[model samples]
Target: MPHIKNALIRYRIIDKALGNTYNPYPSKLDLRHACEMELYGDTNGKHISDSTIEKDLFAMRQEMDAPIKYSKAHKGYYYDNPDFTINEKPLSEDDLTSIQFALSTLSQFKETEMFQNFGFALNKIIDRVNVDSDARKSDADIDQMIQFEKSTAAKGNEFLQPLLSAIQHQYIAYFMYESFVTQVKKQRKVTPLLLKEYNNRWYLICFDSVKEKVITYALDRISDLEIIEQVGEKPSDFKADLFFRHSIGITASAEARPEKIIFSAGNIAAKYINSQPFHESQKIVLDTLEHTKFELFALISEELIRELLSYGGDIIVQEPNSLKDELVKRIKQMKTNYNI
Candidate 1:
């Protein structure tokens, strides 16, 4: 259960002294000096304090559950049981497995820019896990057995920390945002509330005081951000769950409402959709070898249309004439654009 390797080394040194029959009763100074010699060698390096020795003994007894006991006559530490050794208690198999699993899970984010500041701490834990497990299970080893999605140098990830800080500190943030449709940039002042990530893209979901509504803004299109001023109280009316209740991707249109939209997908697209659903509200109405039908209670946003279109001939819109007509109109526009 040693977090750092030095603790393990100190435990071994104490174990050796405690179990040494000839050395019998090594006092506190004897233990500390022995540890310094073993760790720092004959270099006369900074001596470890008596408290350090005391803590090491305490950690051994408490953390490792070592049978350590003090003899009043000997005036030193010794083990109640003579046969116990530090080597016999590395880490339980279950413990090692859990630590390895945690390291593997963290390996997914260790490479991302968002995790760079924590790289040293993460790497130290990884190294400790490797040593404790007695297996050099690097990222490559985990990759061979199980694959994880590759990390990207995703845009707007840099803003995550600052936006989260602003939210925590109750501050208003000012930034210039570029509109995708209008192709125009405009200054926006908003109360920072939340940072959302979807499909590796970052988004700022905040209350727009000027517009008197909650809105989602893409981080990539945002620039020149400044934490403007402190706000007395955040808009209590804005509930994240309610705001994104009918969301599709990052755009939760103010005018849109959640409605049931049913669609059928061919074999290939059905396989993909079954693996990764379109939305949380997506439900399979029917499943078969040829085509599978699905129903989604979600907003009919541009992202929904765009992703559905990505499936091309593999999917058919089966209900809600409004969505079908919109798709038809888009298809016609696409054909006209292609001069087909």
Candidate 2:
């Protein structure tokens, strides 16, 4: 398999050798022999060298920060603390409790095809923790202590794993996509670049071959997804950070450029804004007793407009007369809706 996989297998063999207290104290040669037997099997007389075992020990201690130390008295390598294992660090009681709750929450997705891989990963973690001495609580006691957040049922979630795999392996993805504007499903192929989540919805950022530009497609609107056998071309010029840097949400306007946006919030709302900023580019332009004036460098998109409108009269757009005018128009439309 892969080099990393081989390294992990070697580490496991080394760890098992050291942790075996019943066996005679293992020397460097003993460890190397153990690794080779596990790797190539007993019939193959070929074995790893002393240097390779030394590097594995050094990496485990220095790179992995494992508490490994050679014991002169024992005449072998072992964990500085006998209770420790190289596979995973010992979990705190609180950490174990949190993991139990997280496992419980994730278990809800165990039956879904999309979460099959996730379920396997979760089971490994559960097995690892269950083996730990600190995790001794009974199942009923764990159930009593933790409650998961209620999740709403969502469609198209089953496509998440396949799309994620496509993005990771740089595969061209074929799917039937239905846009909100057209309401007509169309078969399309795109180079999957990145997966993003916004407001509880997942979106795939991909290079659309037909359009010859990058586009964002909501997962909820995608169906009949498949990964093409051919490898996709990764755009050298595209940077995800720069692509979404100016825009507030996924809907980015190709023609729009970043502009200075100044807005003022009431004292109460200012505290909230200061604590949870709207954007990384947000700055406190002016703070006075009357109100707090903040400025942001961003493209004015529909999401930004909606966010500003959500604040109602608590926030005022002070600059870019265009943004203020749009807010006014939307407010008027709201007034008409209410027949005010």
Candidate 3:
């Protein structure tokens, strides 16, 4: 297909010709030069004639809404307006840096509608930056980091889209799921409540109507998701945070109410809980120089235990003797199997 919109062409021109210095509003000569470079690329001695360049520039200025400006000093042209701009709320240097960081992180989402939406917002902000000097400190490394996230976001979207559709349409979604306990290829009918992206992979938080409860189905294990037209209403007052609040994963059923469970963490595990709180009700119960006890108000699930076990000897469940006994029983079963 013909490159009619020419986003790449426009982007390259802005990068090379303007070099962040030329006001997005620029003179005639600059436009001419940019157009030539964009169309032909470093033709050495063979350049577009000045008259043809002027004609092209005039046509572009008349037809397109590109920001172009004329400068008397250099006797050339520049962008009259930025391609896009953003009007952001008043921010400190740190705030601006944080926003820039967020934008960079969010850039990974560029190809998706979400990224494009944010880009539109960012463009308006960039246009409003009245910095006269084009030579802002070069940060290629930071740009690279931003670019990497954008690429990762594109790949992540492959799983997110369908789950999103299922949640929106209120369709019963059928997926081939691997049972975490049984390790069996089981087909399930679920009312997809929300799509959650924790760590890296996408997870479908859904009400398993057949199982008569909610469950978290890993997107990786899901295959052949056919949305059934027969719709069921999501439970009234169904808040995702409340549903998954106490549980570590999607294993918590309505059969269990919220409970406060205390766990002890030594060394790095304590540090982890301090920085990344488990839930809203997480609090430091006991603190010593070597160890810390945390009270987490959440429904204790098998997933929560697995997360605790993954911490090895660093974390110990201090409360809920039922859960502790279950862990102990598992340990004994393992020992018996090993004849130890």
What TM-score does each of the candidates earn? 0.57, 0.57, 0.51
Count of backbone collisions in candidate 3: 30
Q: Write the per-residue lDDT of candidate 3 for residues 1-340, one digit (tens) a residue.
A: 1232233234334433543341334454555556665567643426555665555545445544345566677675566554432122233344345445545555577668656745765665544331311223442334333322232332223346556767878887777877778888988888899887655567787888887766777786766667777686577767876666666655556567877788889967899878977766889978998999899778777777777777878888867898798778877887899999
Winner of 1 and 2 under TM-score? 2
Task: Please list all clashing residue pairs in model 2, or write none if there are none.
Answer: none
Off by over 4 Å in 3: 1-159, 180-186, 228-230, 267-269, 333-340
RMSD of each: 17.2, 16.4, 15.9
Candidate 1 has its poorest 10 consecutive residues by lDDT at: 134-143
Highest-TM-score candidate = 2
Best by lDDT: 1
Q: Write the per-residue lDDT of candidate 1 for residues 150-262, one digit (tens) a residue.
A: 55756665567568878888798988999999999999988887788777788998878778677789998888888866872467666665777777887775566788999
lDDT of 1 at 283: 85
Better of 1 and 3 by lDDT: 1
Query: TM-score: which is higher, 2 or 3?
Result: 2
